[model samples]
Structures are given as C-alpha cells and as structure tokens.
Target: MKKVIIPLALCLITAACGGDENDGKTEPEMKISSCYVVSSSSGQSENFSSPVGMYITSEAGQPYEGSGVWSASYNSGAWAMDKPVYVTKAGKVYAYYPYSSNDSPPVLPLDMTRQTDVLYSRVASPIAPGSVSLSVKLYHALSKLVVSVKGEEVTGLSLSSPVKCRFNICTGEFTDLQSGQVTSTDGRLFVVPHVTVGKEMIITLKSGKQYTYSVDGTEFRAGESYTYEFQLNEDRDKLEILDISVEDWINDNNYNDYLRR
Candidate 1:
C-alpha cells in the first residue's frame, strides 16, 4: 500500500511548532555535537569520536543490559540508570531514550543497526551525494558508516512528515516518505525518508564524486530541524553510485497512497 502525498498534512508538519504557544524549550534541538567521525571504545573526550555511542552487544546489534550507570547512581558514585551511558569501542556516551524493549537491550557492536532508520537517494545534479561530518567511525566490526543527522542538517528545507522513524541501518533502495519517488516537480528530489533517530540511509554514488549536504524532518509534536553533513567514498566498498532518480508519478496525491505502505 503506497502512501499519497498529503499537502495539507505536510504543511502541518513543515509548519508545526513555528508558532507554538507552549513553554517552548524547543524540541530536543535534534543536534548532537560529537568530536570524531567514528567513536572509539576507549579514549579521552577529545580522542573519542562518533555520531552516537552506547554500550552495545557483540553478538546482537542492541544496547547492552548496562544498568549501574543507567540507574542514576553513577554520579552519586554508585551505578544506576539515568547516569551517562557509555560504550567500549569508542567509550562514547550514548543518549538514553525510552524504547519498546527494556529487559535485555540489544547493543549493536560496531553497527548500530538497531538504531538506524531508512536511507534515500536521487540524482539532483551529476555531482555525487554525501555529507561532511562522519559522526561515527566505520568500524569493520561495527558498520560501514555511522552518520548523525542533526537539526543543522535540514535548515531552510521543509520536512513533510514522519516518513520512516526507526534505528535499523541496512542497505537497500528506500521509498520516499514525502513523495515516494526519486524526483520532484522542480527536478529536485528528496532521496531521504521523512523520519529520524534510529535510521540512516546509505548508497553508493557515482564512481567518483563528492558533495556537501544536510537532512532534517518536520514533527508536529516537535519542531523541524536539519543536519549539516558531507560524504566521501571509503576504501571499503567498491560499488558504483546508483544515481537513479524517481519519476514524477509521486506527489500526484492520488498516484497510489497504498504503495508507500
């Protein structure tokens, strides 16, 4: 079941929080300032770097059953929940968020697939697609890339809606959350999904190309934010860029609302 583009709903998302009257601290800011592209299991604050960090599991890609610190007693000297959560690979502190699971959390080793979302791509110009900041390091034992799409990434651009909210990082040809196609009216296409946190789309660009880019999402309950980033080819993968753009069959509003499903 594909989802049709809802201009009204999109307007609501893109315009949400712009004129809110609540206490207004603003949504979590969506910006997570880190030092390195890849996080290290053990290192100083300056030496440690990566997008997001948390104690992960070696076998299963999930958060470790790390309690003590999570208990909130760590600052008190003892271990407790709520205290800053740290991982080994980069020893970076992973922000804690309430999820569906609680018992035995799955901490992704080098690859935080459990916290990755959907990835998108399209050909706007002949130039390649990528970001400048590599939040997390591509740990051969972890993942190919660990990007963090903060508020700075998507500034002026409008976020339509929650296209895909997940943390599962996997390789695939993703569907657009807003239009579902690779191309838009003006020829500019949104290759990324409409969701955030828990998801990072990945794809190989033209054999040789590079570009600076950013990403963001609009949230009715929260404000809209963008992430400033850039991407360059790594020595790991040797695949050529899949610079395929989608047709305008999308955003038709009635093309196939069920297709996006």
Candidate 2:
C-alpha cells in the first residue's frame, strides 16, 4: 500500500509539471521604437535623446495601469519603457517632457524660473492591439523668451508675468492664470503662452539700479519663441529694444547670434 501511494503521488506531480507552459504568461508588450519632437515652424522632427514620461488610456477615456516613463536606450537608441506596456486593447497614448509620476491625465504647473522646456504629444487615433512598435511626435507646449543684453552691466533680470498656470498635458493648453514675478540671471524664461499688454520686464544692474520696460502688445503663442535684444543707453537707466525676432523654438537658428556682442 505504501509503494502504491508513492507511485501515485509521483505521477500527479509529473502531470502538474507538464501542463501548458504558456497558460499564465502575460500578453505581448508594446514598445516605443522612435520618439521625436516636431518643429512647429519648419515642420522638422528631431529625435528624443532623453527620457520622458508617458500615459496610456483606453478609447473610452480609461487610464491604463501600465503607464510609465520611457527613455532612449544607450545601445539600441530606441525609446523603451521602464515597465512592460501591453497593448492588449485599443487605446491612446500621451507623452510629456520633464517626466513626473502623476499618471492621471498628466498636468504640469508652469515654473517660469526653471527654464525647462515643456513638451506634449498625443496619438490622434486609437492604437490597435498587437502593435509592437509606436512612434511618438511631441510639440512644444509653452512659449520661450530669450532676452539678450548689450552695453549694460547687468546683474539680474525678472519678468512681471503670469507665474501661475496649469498646463494641460493632453491638449497642450495653459489655463488658470495668475499674475506674479519670475526672476532670472541668464535672461531666459519659459512662460505660459498668452498675449501681453501691461506686463513689465525688470533689469537690474551691477550698481543695484533697476530699469523697467513695458512688454506691451507682445503675443506669445504655443510652440513659438521670441528673442528680445536690448541696448542700454550711456546713462544706464534706460533700455532700448535693439531687435525682436519671432520663430519656432526648435527651428530657431539665430538664437545664439542675438547674444553675441
């Protein structure tokens, strides 16, 4: 009786071990093969060299649990997610720069002092299942301001603009505006896209003297960049606009030229 029981136990263990190998395996993962930022001015696409956060949602506006960050691989130069993102059903995807962990419809608050570029992208159509590769195209979500000073012993600069704004990652729009000050030392600021009428640009000198100029009638649009070249008079109390140029952020080639003395 003991020998028969041992043989029966061994047979049951063998049968369990020989079951389907693929029974509990997860679905195939969807990988992002290529990601690029498109120039709004030139319609040119530049490959992403850094990591960005992404979110996936179903066609019915339900968020996918597998959403996570993606970055370019050092060896293959392809964008890969930190975790497996299964494309088991039809869904949409959204991506943003300066990755954050907030997975719910990814909204970013404008940090004018950081000078960080805000970018966003969304898939227009629902991606079908079994798609092994995806290509994402991102666009600039905020306007860039480049200020260059000439003939001035400047110490610092700041803009009296809307400092509080909620940037919608999906729609690439800015809302809930509030006015405040944003300071800078290098004369670069990433601001919410809006029209300026009564805002002020403050310039500080080595002597601690400050000058003000009205940023009137200037319109800052999404995906656009503006350069304001200023020349200080002999009195050093006034700033005159030397040049103003508007171009797409990614396609602007003359940005550095404005800083050259």
Worst 10 residues of 1 by lDDT: 120-129
Q: All candidates' TM-scores?
A: 0.21, 0.81
Kindly give the number of clashing pairs for every candidate. 75, 0
lDDT tens digits by residue: candidate 1, 97-214? 2222342222211112122221111111011112211122222111111122221121122222233322322222223233221212221223232334332233223332222222
> How far off is residue 33 in model 2, in Å?
1.2
lDDT of each: 0.25, 0.69
lDDT of 2 by residue, 75-165 (tens): 3656667667766788777777767555445566766766566778744324666665777777787777777778556667788777887
Top of the candidates by TM-score: 2
Cα-based RMSD of the predictions, in order?
25.6, 5.0
Which ranges in model 2 have alpha carbons more than 4 Å from their true place? 1-6, 23-26, 43-46, 66-76, 122-125, 152-155, 205-208, 251-261
List candidate 1 stretches off by more than 4 Å: 1-35, 38-51, 61-63, 66-164, 169-261
TM-score for candidate 1, please give it.
Answer: 0.21
Which model scores highest in lDDT?
2
